[model samples]
Target: MSAEVSGVRIGVEERRARLRARQLAAVDDVAEVVEGLVALHATDPATVFLSVAARLCRPSGAIAAVEEALYGSGSGPGSGPALVRMMAMRRTMFVVSRESAPDVFAAAGRDIAARERTKLLEHLARGGGWDAAWLAEVEAEVEAALDRHGESGGARLSALVPRLREQVVVGRGKPYETTQNVASRVIRVMAAEYRIERRRPAGSWTSGQFRWARAEPLPERPVGPAREAVVRAWLRAYGPGTEADLKWWTGWTLTEVRKALKAVGAETVRLDDGAGHILPGHILPGDTEPAEPPPPGPVLLPGLDPTPMGWQDRDWFLPRSHRAELFDGTGNVGPTVWWGGEVIGGWAQRADGSVVWRQLTDRGAEAAGAVDRAAAELVGLLGGVRITPRFRTPLERELSA
Candidate 1:
């Protein structure tokens, strides 16, 4: 029995790649990495796109480095763009351009807004209110915006009528959706366009009051070769996980996930469930090694960060008891702070972009200090050139007060 247990532990370690392969093969090439991301139909390509795009600050010149890669820049530099498009920068919670949010939205123009709002509201209404005339109005506004902005992704919005109509409703003035609903539908539409296989909608999506809610959905089919390539790439970026973990991260079913695994069967190995929570002998890469755990300092991952929320078996990384605090009733995981490999607390960013974190543990100041530095670093990297760090500490009396 001891020998059998020892062998399984060894196999588990090998699957996690701690045992061999000095230069993790999966992480070797950036180009291949981008291709893999594109293939997975990563839930929010914008997030991954912005993340790698920011690799611009890395020793490799950002544009020069990304230009040669498969995902490349999804939105090339342009004059002005819309909030939805500009919000893409928010995926990283940082924008690389000097343009203010208003400027970006202004560039998006009222027409683009009309269309996005139209499409968004339609989904909120759930196939009501949005009509041919409403859509036509939005289309006209979109064309005018294109003429003003001189051609951008927003311009392509004019051509996505079929998809737009499928997801939204054209109704009377102010279509029946709320701000949250609009935000949700925009993400959903983008995911669909990215061809991501899974997107689960928030519970509010069913509430008539909510025109839309951002939740992941399970794609009709696991993404094909190109998309599969991206899924494999995600494993490299965020792996040492089980097949169930991948399914949880992307909202695909076990059956579809298994098929996708078969697609990449040659590159992975199975890990025995030494943890006992997940199935034993789960597939992980034999040559994969855990990335050195991220520095012990605190880092503020954006509200919709893919890291903590990436795997289904979140308890493996997070304490099961505190899960409810971060995950809402609708299953949305908000902005969270990480200290070492475990989550320490929740955070919210105010209008000035100052970050306020509520620690669930005593690591508050220690973690906040690190997150403060990281936020400043990211903000500066995004074109602020210089960003000041400010941490909000909740007073003990205030808790009782």
Candidate 2:
């Protein structure tokens, strides 16, 4: 319907325009796409590459463009258009522009690291004779091992630092209790702190099994300004979103969300569900005709694509009935077909490397034809490389099958 600014309703068409204007199109480059959207959701390895492929004017070599920007900097740490895969908001993995990486770390990664560190220490204590000092010592040993080889997997690092191989019990009294080696967990903590990074995996880009390498820590900045910058970017890219949406996306508390919004001088707007915020001075079209929005999209976006996952409240852009079919129980989205600003269907690649799709709702024949062209083009672009969503959903399963 319409969004409210001082009780003035901003229409959905206007909302769609705001987002598309900030997003990259075929004319844009890899860095622009990654930075424009704040970051590309990278929980699924193929998601990052496929997202880029969808936005480029020429899908050919777009995958390489993403790789060059992300791993191109070097096995070592540096920043520019270069991208870094790091854990951010909601503890989900994302590939963000290197320039904004530091602020993202300050705003979200640092908090995640601190919380994870605390939990890890508590787990260590229960294991007996292990504490922060022990963790530090082992972390150093792991780093030293990485330096020796330049890149190493958890298995190698664990062997090098025997302490890493030591077991710790978690969920001690719970039904799902299990034991884990300290190796991978420690590496994750270091990554959260920016002490090291995951380099490209030894296998195809689709593989999540990645290796680790020592990385220069992210440049430090005060949390206040950093959070402000991050919030500003979020509002600019995904604006007119409610506090709950930002809170759910960023995993920040209401206080932190409010403070950041104030620092950015964000303006409150009325959304269908409740109040939302937009960057100051962002003028929504008056009740008159909304500025001609971008043409309807038939782009095929991978599962966990950032757009759908950008907000907790999905009603404005997502069909209510299709939610269960497209999304997993925990909210990760599967490969979705977007016909303009809304999700119209879901697609999956068959085992034979052909793409198959099922419309959750008919979008008319013309839209269906466009969807077909997009799917066929993706088949050729993939060149027979198949993808399986890291998080599978009912519709994707049915379509692929």
Candidate 3:
């Protein structure tokens, strides 16, 4: 005979309302989002970088908006060439949500194209070397051909030549390798008819990937707003986080982050995390998790998702000491496989969409089966409608208790 009364039971609706309120508070307009990141930078530099990246590169966001803000006028490098050079050194990789890859590529391509033209013309004027004269001659020819095409679809190819050349140089490691190299280098020059860089002829596509001909020099100016937007976005995705947390994610200085945050006023909130420390608002729920959070789904998060890499005090979801285990040297979070709110494993998909998983520990076949389901879910996100499990690796056999 069991008739038991609970010590403390809160109605589910009440908990949901509280949680919803906290989540809703985190919802911010694009502008507000921008402001918050500026503030975030003030408190934590690295975090601002990561947060901004998260914003510009969500599963469904655009890079152009942020790009313009950074390079358009304010604090960022105003010159396109300088911006490209600067961005090149920014080696930090941001994951382009699988769905937004097209748009991201387009925007990045535009930036690449504009910067290449300027670089070509400027480099030619400066008299770099052999590649310069050849590039200059090619620009003239390409422009003449474009004149015939009357700036239509064909001109796009003309415009794109310089871009392709730039990619080749960057990817291939040498500018004058063979006929293909000479052709690409000359094509870019002919298309632009503007002076070209002899030492740094732009590159082109090879085997699919675009290569950077010459090392992109660092950006000449600060990409303020654009950078700020990226920071804000990260916080939105993984907030209620500390400025230090933000710093760990971004690579900016605390001073820069502070300036950005100051720009964003009440739109951003600072909440205490039980301790005296204040952090971004979203991560801190006014209430605790209901006996359960959502039933863990098999979600295949992009390599750059904020969910896994955004927080600094990750003990809530992961063992704090091992946080570095999931991250690479550049602070890029690897692809993570999740069963619930926490990460249980990691997976990778080859270009062909073959799925492979590596579990953190041996959980046996039952766990292996769950990973299979999760991998399928991930493949769907990557545009592959269906995925077949090819293989799995367990870190070690079941440990003796």
TM-scores vs. true structure, each candidate: 0.48, 0.90, 0.42
Please write out the lDDT profile of model 1 over residues 135-162, one tens digit for every residue. 4554445445434543234213435323
Error of 2 at 16 (Å): 2.2
Question: Over all chains combined, what TM-score does candidate 1 have?
Answer: 0.48
Candidate 1's C-alpha runs over 4 A off are 1-224, 266-278, 281-285, 288-290, 351-353, 362-368, 372-401
lDDT (10s digit) by residue, model 3, range 8-113? 2333233233322322123223233333322222111122222343333242232333333322333445432211211111223232322222232232222444
* RMSD after CA superposition, every candidate: 12.0, 3.9, 14.0
RMSD of 3: 14.0
lDDT score for residue 81 of model 1: 17
List the candidates ranked by lDDT, beginning with the highest. Answer: 2, 1, 3
TM-score order, best first, reads: 2, 1, 3
The model with the greater lDDT, 1 or 2, is 2
How high is the CA lDDT of each candidate model?
0.40, 0.79, 0.39
Ten-residue stretch with the least lDDT total in model 3: 392-401
Q: Which candidate do you rate higher for TM-score, 1 or 3?
A: 1
Q: What overall lDDT, based on C-alpha atoms, would model 3 receive against the true structure?
A: 0.39
